[model samples]
Target: MSILDDLRDRGLIQQVTDEEGLEKHLNEDRVALYCGFDPTADSLHIGHLFPALMLKRFQEAGHRPIALVGGGTGMIGDPSGRNEERSLNEENVVKEWSNNIKDQLSKLIDFDDAKNGAVVVNNYDWLSQMSVIDLLRDVGKHFSVNYMLAKESVEARIEHGISFTEFTYMLLQSLDFLRLYQKENCTLQIGGSDQWGNITAGLELIRRSSQEGESAKAFGLTVPLVTKADGQKFGKTASGAIWLDEKKTSPYEFYQFWINTDDRDVIKFLKSFTFLPLEEISELEKSNTEHPEKREAHRKLAEEMTQMVHGKASLDQAVRISQALFNGDVKSLSKDEVALGFKDVPSFDLEESEKPLIDLLVEAKISSSKRQAREDIGNGAIYINDERQTDLQYNLDDKDKIDGAFTIIRRGKKKYFLIRH
Candidate 1:
């Protein structure tokens, strides 16, 4: 099947500006496409993964992909569907985020000069230099205020009030595309469906800025916004954003995130996220019918995505940690491993000296009250490092430490704890 055919089969095509035209363009040698990523945060979260995945798909299909970081546009946050204006981050903060975002994006797309190698660009380079008059006379005249205001992004903010900084966001963003189109010969832009307005704006800028009858034209495609079956935003847990960076989120937590994908969302996610062959995925799905409890499909999805994002070693580490936790073998992990493995697991820290097991248990809020903690220990519901602690007087001492470190506690069958050394 052709590239567009594959994209269609995989359900990646959300809304392309002109499907026939775009397919025709891609049939040519190495279609140059670009996607914009706003460096609004220090690390690219799972929310950013859709575009990156799309870019990866395009490159694998023998197209050049360019990633644009919204260094300049990030300063004036895109007011797309925001109920309130975003707090503008400082220049230094945005710059640092832009660089860090670049690093994160680098991990997702290959930057080598082979395999339709991806190129990275920052909007700040061009947007910072354009004079107001230069922008208005040269690019702004092509778009009417009426057309801009008609967009849902702008119209939604009309009642809430949008700042001049935010209102001009499209202009800055459009310039990124125009600049990349000029510098990299990029012809297609892709992003989340919310970026349709911005992408179309960039296309208009490109169509207008070229010389009279200049044969320069481009297209826009957007992926659907991922939402949970539960109607919650994707990429969010109770703890917050699932970052690509390990420092912000552990591989263990990341692994759990994918493994926890609801039954309704798993197949859709596999299609959107993984580069797995369609037939193989279909067969995997078929297994669900034959053996429901295996959760084999979910396991494969979790492993593939975890390894892709966190590398094999991290996935292995996470899996090993998973095994250790499942078998109630807390002794199998060292202090550092325990920390990383259970970072999201419920826990409380205390000095080994001041570590009254009751106080620690009460403080972790694992137990409802100090008396309850004592009672639970007496009831044989309490475990310290997987060993049932029958004594209420069990003051945690260094002698009971794991590698001179923690005492894992459990108040019930589900809850877990880690005490510090």
Candidate 2:
């Protein structure tokens, strides 16, 4: 199937300037397309995955994909979905963020140039050099004040007020598209549904600036805004945004996020996030309905996404940590795995003296009171490193410590505690 067809099947396509024309252009030539990402943070989060992965989809279809880093536009945040104006970041700060984003994209796209290799470009390269007079005479002259005011991005912020810097974000983005069309022969721009206005504005700038005038082949496409069935935004957790950067969110955490996908959302996510074929996905969907208890779809989604973003080694570690936790096989976990598994669980520092496991459980507050702790122990509901401890006087030793750094404790089926030496 055509890449566009694949995206449509996956429910990725939301808005397109001209569906027929885009399909013709994509099929007739080795079209070059781009998606711009603003560097608002040092690391890209899961929210940024749609466009980045979409670029990969295009490249796999034998088209050139240009990943545009919005260093210039990022300095003046786009008021696309915000109710209030954004605070401008320092020039150096935006530049640093731009660099970090570039590094992250480098891993996702194949830039080897073996066959239509991907490219990363920074808008700051050209936008930073353009003078105010040049911008006004060349690019700014094409956009009418009424036209800019009517766009959804600016219209929403009219009540609260938006600064001139942010108001001009669309123009900067348009300039990026125009520059790419002129220099790189790029004919398409894709982004999230929120960027439909900016993408179309870019198409407008390309058409007016081109000799083709109104007949320019420049087009725009946008993916649907990711939303969950539970009425919450995608890519967010109780902790906060799930960052793509491992340092910001660990591979294990990222895996856990996808592994815990809602049953209602699992099949849809598999279609959107994984490169697995439609046949395989359909089979998984059938399995999802037949054996919902197994959570096959959820596991596949987590495995595919974790491997895609974090690499094989990290995916393995995530699986190991997850399995160990599920099986209550704490001894199988390494020190780092222990830390990753119990990172958010309650933890206490032992005084480096021998303490009964029951005392430690009470001391760590895993049990509400000494009576409950004793009762839990005697009932064989307490576990020290996955081994049931029925003896009320069981004491923790250095051997019980995983790597001499931590000990995992389980009080009953659900509660877990960590003890650090």
Candidate 3:
């Protein structure tokens, strides 16, 4: 299948400016395409995977991919999906975020010196140098006030309020497409469905700025906005946004996010988020339908995504920790693995000593009182390091610690506690 066909099969394509023309252009030449990412945060989150991976898809199809860092546009912020106007970040902060976003993009595409190697460009390089007068004359004149206001992005914010800085954002993005088309021979721009307006604006700018007729012009495509079957948003967990950076969200945590995907969403996510072949995904889909409890699709999606975003070593570590936790083999986990497994569980810090299990349970608040703790312990309801302890005098010591850093306690089947020394 062609690249566009594959995208359609994956349900990635939402809207395209010129489907037939764009298909012919892609098939006939080594087209250059660009996707702009606004650096609103230091790290790109799970929400960014679609377009980031789309760049890789194009590169794999022998096309050049230009990952545009919105250093200039980011300062003004895109008002596409927001309910209110965004508070602008400082130049220094946006600059730092731009650099971080560049690094994140590098992880998703090949930047090696080859024919189809990806290239990273910052809009600030050109946009920052243009004077306000030059912007108004060169780019601003192309966009009419009525045309700008008609866009969904601006229209949504009209009642709440939209600032002039935000109102002029379409011009800046259009300038990006125009500049890329002129300098890099870029002919296509892609982004999320929410960016359809911006993407088309860029295409309009490309046509208006060019001396060529309809035979030669830029195009735009957008991936569908992700949604959940349960009426919740994709890429969100109880904790918050799942970031690409390991520091913001650990590999284990990220893995858990995918592994826990609702069954209804897993197969769709496997299609959209993973590079696995259609045949393999079909087999997994069949397995999922036959045995939903096994959750084969969920495991595959989690494994593929975790390995892609984090390295093999990190994915391996995450799996090791997950398996150990699941098997009740908590004692076998290393110190770092313990930290990752119990990072969010109830925890307490205490000095190491030969404290009776009942007293420790009471102190850790695993039980309401010493009497209740002793009663639970006598009934074999308390466990240390996954081992049942029925003796009321059972004491926790250094030997009970996992790698001498922490101890895991289970008050019942579902409740887990972590004690640090």
**lDDT for each candidate structure:** 0.84, 0.90, 0.91
Off by over 4 Å in 1: 114-117, 212-215, 345-374, 391-399
Give model 1's TM-score versus the native structure. 0.93
Between 1 and 2, whose lDDT is larger?
2
- Write model 1 residue lDDT over 289-395, tens digit each, in one string: 68868887788888998999989999998888877988989788878778887676766667447567788778888788998988898899998888888888778
For the record, the alpha-carbon RMSD of candidate 3 to the native fold, in angstroms, is 1.0
Residue lDDT tens for model 3, 161-280? 989999899999999998999999999999999888888888777777788845556899999999999999888888999999999999999999999999889889998989999989
RMSD of each: 2.4, 1.3, 1.0
Q: Deviation in angstroms for 53 in model 3?
A: 0.7
User: What is the RMSD of candidate 2?
Assistant: 1.3
| Clash pairs for candidate 1 | none
Q: For residue 41, what is the lDDT in candidate 3?
A: 93
Return the TM-score for candidate 2, rounded to 2 decimals. Answer: 0.97
User: What lDDT does model 2 reach?
Assistant: 0.90
